[model samples]
Target: MNPVVYTVDLEVRWRDLDAFNHANNASYLGYIEEARVRWFKSLSADWAGETAAPIMAAVQVNYRRPVNWPETVRVELFAERVGNKSLTLGHRILSACDGDVLYCDGHTVLVWVDRGGQSVPLPDAVKAACAG
Candidate 1:
């Protein structure tokens, strides 16, 4: 079954540009981070350290095209793999004005951890949410 995707729209800020006048590569990660946070919030997941939280374990991004300011981008997040203690979320950033234009694509691995920072089992609710 195809996993359900969570999406968020973000406007490219002028500050996100580099001297080259395109969105900086580092800024792409920030966009992904925002989308992830929004996705977690949508799930009502306790990600803010109430007890256990998900932490970034790894990230991989591929730049397909440059994004400029005065543009809106759509970020989509889907569960790629849900594991015992970690999950890989696949993401794509595209022009909100034209979904056909993909600006960046990537996946991030997040591990559930306790306050002590040791890996722990993912909550059932989180697993269910990732299922779709």
Candidate 2:
């Protein structure tokens, strides 16, 4: 198992559900994104600056169970790997009421990009932040 570096609790909204009364498939991506953004902000307050921002390159998600509204989900984020120009993040979305029940799991790769949207080597500061 990857080490969890950050975690957040997000509420399931009514609109997130589908005809089956469970969260739509696309909603899981938003949940993971919320955790990722929060983790980035925790690493650096000015993480959104133009010159050294990261962009999502790819994402892969596996749904384990359905989630319903009026519930709180726990999203755990991990810094699985730090590369020269990218960061590989692992995530687990669990049922807040019961931590052992996993709702979804995924990985995302973020590439560091410059103002012109070209890939660049990650900054030293960014590396240091992930080292923890």
Best by TM-score: 1
Residue 69 C-alpha lDDT in model 1: 82
Which ranges in model 2 have alpha carbons more than 4 Å from their true place? none
lDDT of each: 0.88, 0.88
Q: After superposition, how far is residue 71 of candidate 2 from its true place, in Å?
A: 1.2
TM for every model, in the order presented, reads 0.93, 0.92
The lDDT, on a scale of 0 to 1, for candidate 2 is 0.88
Per-residue CA lDDT of model 1 for 1-132, tens digit only, reads: 245478899999999999989999999999999998887776774655578988999999999999988899999988899899998999999999999999999899999998898899987767888775
Residue 24, model 1: lDDT of: 97
Weakest 10 consecutive residues of candidate 1 by summed lDDT: 40-49
Q: Candidate 2's error at 20, in angstroms?
A: 1.2
